[model samples]
Each structure stands twice: as C-alpha cells, then as structure tokens.
Target chain A: MKNQLTVILAILLFFGTAGFSFAVKPGEQLSDPKLEQRARTISKGLRCVVCQNQSIDDSDAELAGDMRKLVRERILAGDSDQQVKDFMVERYGNFVLMKPPLAVNTLGLWLSPVLFILIGVGLFWHVSRRKPQTKKPIDTDETEHRLEEVLNKMKKN
Target chain B: MKIQPIKFLPVIILLGIGIAFAFGLRNDPSKLASTMINKPWPDFTLERVIADQPAFSREDLHGKISLVNVFGSWCAACVQEHPMLMRLANREGVIIYGIDWRDTAEAGSAWLEKYGNPYRKVGLDANSRLAIDLGVTGAPETFLVDKNAQIRFKVVGPIDEKIWTEQLKPMIQLLQNET
Candidate 1:
C-alpha cells in the first residue's frame, strides 16, 4: 500500500510539472466575449512558425504570445475571422496557417496519400488476379502419361 | 522477352520518393519565410528610446532607402551585430532606423549608450505591437525598406560582413537606382 501511494504521488508530481512547463503567457482579453472567442478560434488555426508544430494558441514561445495578442487586437478592431487569418498569412506566409489552404503549393501534400492508396489498391488487385493462373495445376492425364513414358524408358535402359 | 511497364512501377515510385527527400533535405525548416516582402512597411507610432527624443512613425521611414533593425538589450545576438550596424551607419549613406522590441525604455537607452547608438531614430516597442505587424520573430531581425516605404528584404539573423557585402549592399544599390 505504501509503494502504491508513492507511485501515485510520483505520477501526480510528474503531471503537475508537465502542465507548468507548457503554460502559455496569458494574452490580453477583450471585454466582448464573442470577439474574444473569434480571436481564440483564429489563434488556434495559426501556427507558431518558431515552434513549428504548435499553434499560437497553445505555444508558450514569446512570438506565439505576440501573435495571440495581434489576433485579439485585430478581432477587436472589427476585422472578420478571414481577415485575421489573411493578416497573419500576409505577415508570415502560408506556413503560419496550421491548416494550409488547398493551393498550388499544397496540392501534392494534400493529395499524395490518396494517390498512394489508389496505387496500392491497384497493385493488390493486379497481384490477386495473377495468382490463380500461376497456381493452376497441369493436366493430370498428361502428367501421368509423361511419367509412365519416362518410367518405361528407364526400364528399357 | 518484352519488359512490362508494370515491373518498372516500383522503381518509378522509389525515384519519386528519392527526389522528394532531396528537396526536403534542401529546405531549412528553421528559416521562417517573411511574407512582408515587397509589401509597404506597416504603419506604427512608437516613442523614442530616449526620454527627451521625439517619437517616430511610418512617415519617417519614407523618402529614402532605410534599414529598420529590430533589436533589444536582452538579445545577445544584437550585441554581435551592433558593431556591423555602427559601421554601416558611419560608412553608408542610408539611414538606419531602430525598433527596440519588447525591451524596457531604460535598458534600451543604456544599451545604446554603451554599445554606441547607430540609428538615425530609435523607436521603443515596449508592447511589441509594431513588431508583430512587421513580422519580427525575435530581436535582431532587419528589414530594408525602399524609398517608397516597401519592405524589400528581411534578414533574420545577425548581419556580418558577408551578408552586408553580398546580399544587402547589392539590394541597396538596386533600390537606390530606382529612385
């Protein structure tokens, strides 16, 4: 029981510190909750380029904090959600958008998996169809007659 | 025997993957693309680093090719690039505008005093609002603005001799010619 209690305490401590490590700097909030919500939604879709994988909303990097504040400011200034995204893109390029739009640059990235799956399915179908022909048995009578003739020739020898 | 095209499919796929990896390896993920290139410099109004100095705005950046350098006392890289900036200010004809990003006014003023102030006008970006508009990821990023107030080039890291001579100087000449 004492060992189990120690394990539980260790788990709790680990998680507690983990949570602290990722704690993002709180951005200035707008009084209008609706606008704030829109800001957050936009933030969630924008990538923190410095952090690479994390969105600005979840990243603790100073740049991410600045970006989050910018999002809020834009929303408060009455820019629409699309405008906010466009503003970020204009400053940081398409890479700043967590969900990159389907465009010429992203066409291959978005479609390659589907293309690969189709190719894989086609190969599988082709291989499955060829299996029966390769595995088909020779004529039983011909095989037996050939064996007999060979045996007879062996006896003559 | 005729070679079937189907037999070459694996090879083609492998070649495709190899080409993709080659391009991928060539890309540096850490080098963030500046989307502000060729766009007009973002408008901003910021106080000067010195208490008594006049505030600076976007208007100050126009009418000449200027180097707007984002810096801070807290940034170690800014120190590394300071001498080069001082040299440029002394030797070059272009104006160097400074944006003190995310730094205290006191620290920024002191840093300039100690390291030597190279800027024609220094703006204090205490809140970093203008820094975001300029797409500054961190301290020590520099943007070269043409006479029309358009951002022509952005350098992410500390500028040394090589960058100034090879990249920046040529661009400055081109912009100068356009004027």
Candidate 2:
C-alpha cells in the first residue's frame, strides 16, 4: 500500500508540474525552436485586447490564441519582429503593444507622471520659500507681558 | 497671508482629477475604437461556408457600399444581432457580406439556415486568420465600407436598433452623399 501510494503521488506531481510548465497550447508552437522562441518573445509583449490586461502569451482567450497564431505565421513568412509588431499595430492600433511607443497619441501618457512630479516639486519649493516669510518670530516683549498678565489674573482668582 | 493662495492648490488639482474621472466614466468600455477606420479593407479570398456558393473577396466590396459583419456560430452575441442584420439587409437595400469567423463551415451554414441568411455572400474564416487581419477581437463586429473598399466606420459589439438609428444611419447618409 505504501509503495502504491508513493507511485501515485509521484505520477500526480509529474503531471502537475508538466501541466503548469506547458502553459502554451499545443499546435501553436512552430517546428523551428528558434522561431518558436522568437514568437513567444513577441507574443509576451502583445496585449490581449479582449482580456485588457494580460499578454497574448499568458491569455487563454480565443482572440489571443488567434493573435499568437498570427504572430507565428508572420514570422514564418519571413517578416522581421518589427514588421510583425507593425502589422499588428496597423490592424489593432498601438493599444495591442504592451509597451506603447512614444508617439503623438501616447506622448502625453508617458510624460504626465514626470510633469506632475515637476509641478509638485515646483509647488513645494514655492510654498516652502513663502513659509518662512509669513512665520516671523513673535515679539518677545508682547509674549512676556501677556504671561505676566495671565499670572496676575490667576493669583486674583 | 501669502500661504492662502497656496492652500487652494491641492483642491484645484483634485478638482481637475475629478473632472477627468467624470469624462472617463462617460465612455463605454465595451465599445472599442477601430483602427481600420479610413483604411483600405484587407484583401482576402475566403472559401464560402455554403459549398456551392461562390467565395468572397475584397473585390466584392467595390461598386457599392457594403457592411461586412464578422460572426461565428459559437458566439451568442451573433445570434442576438442576427435579426438586426436581417432588417438591415431587407430595408436598407445595401449589400451585407458575412465573415464566418472561427467556426466550422457546417455549423455556419446551419446557423444561417436557422436564423434566415441576411448576407449576400458568406466567407468562411475557419482559423480566424482573415478576421484577425480585419482587427476583429470578438464576434458580431460590423464594418461600413465605402465603394472604394475603404472601411469608413466599425461597430465592435451587437448592432441593436439604437446603434443603427443613432450612429450608423447618419454616417451612412454622409458617406452616400460623398461622391
């Protein structure tokens, strides 16, 4: 019984790891290992628009699967990686790319954070500079006179 | 006293962000903007879903305005839009082409038979290769193509009565007037 249980556990462990590691669907892989690797690299950077956040490489959506097939087909047709990416961009717009190119439309998206930080820093500097001007030392004589007045009032009470 | 002006900075920034969010919320996330707008439709020669029927190609789109609808037998949304497509075909008198995307030819033929075929020609995109080229991320997407084969506009989801009357009808009227 012990030996049988060990065999069953080992079989389950092997299948579990195999299933986990082989996430890419079968028949989607190219025969050429180098080309397949390139396809995977390209797919990892292509966003699955249907899922919105996951890459085509990670998504199980039917559209993502089709996109993965398209990437491989283009690569097999002798197009370069850049050409494949351009083809997708032309059809799906720049949204398909995981890392958007610095273009007219996306220029604002890439620079807004930096712009906000600069504005914040400038505001901070401006406010700090003005802070000291308004916060001058209180008149020591006035404070001492007030303290004496308070003490005298307390004695009377 | 000078710091009084600076006190409103955060509030101003927050108000700007709130306005931005309000505009963002007004946008419908389900409607994706098409990249193929104003671009020539991609060339393709797809086998007909019906065996004896002639195959479809980009050339068929010329000489008249056409609506190319991407659909699949497996897609539930396609079924919902089928009645609207039939109405468009009969009432509008415009050519309606079908791209049976990511579906079996037998299933596609059966679906058309059951739902009443609204398309003049049905192209089979068994592997969805041509559908991908057309920027079809899902089923039931419609594209309005001009006589020159340029895709003028696209609708991503089901084309209900509201979309047809409000958005597409006006666009089609304008396109019809052009040349």
Q: What are the Cα lDDT values of the candidates?
A: 0.87, 0.88
TM-scores for all candidates: the values are: 0.83, 0.82
Name the candidate that leads on lDDT: 2
Model 2 CA lDDT for position A120: 87
In Å, candidate 1's interface RMSD is 1.6
DockQ per candidate, 2 decimals: 0.57, 0.63
* Clashing residue pairs for model 1: none
lDDT of 1 at A22: 35
What lDDT is obtained when candidate 1 is compared to the true structure?
Answer: 0.87
For candidate 2, what's the TM-score of chain A, rounded to 2 decimals?
0.66
Local accuracy of candidate 1 as per-residue lDDT tens digits, A1-157: 9999999999999988865453245436677888877877788899987788988878978778878887887787889999999988877788889998999989999999999999999999988887454565889999999999999999999
Per-prediction fnat: 0.72, 0.80
Candidate that would win on DockQ: 2
At residue A24, give the lDDT of candidate 1. Answer: 41
Model 2, span A53-116: residue lDDT tens: 8889988888888889989999999999999999998888888999999999889899999999
Clashes of 1: 0
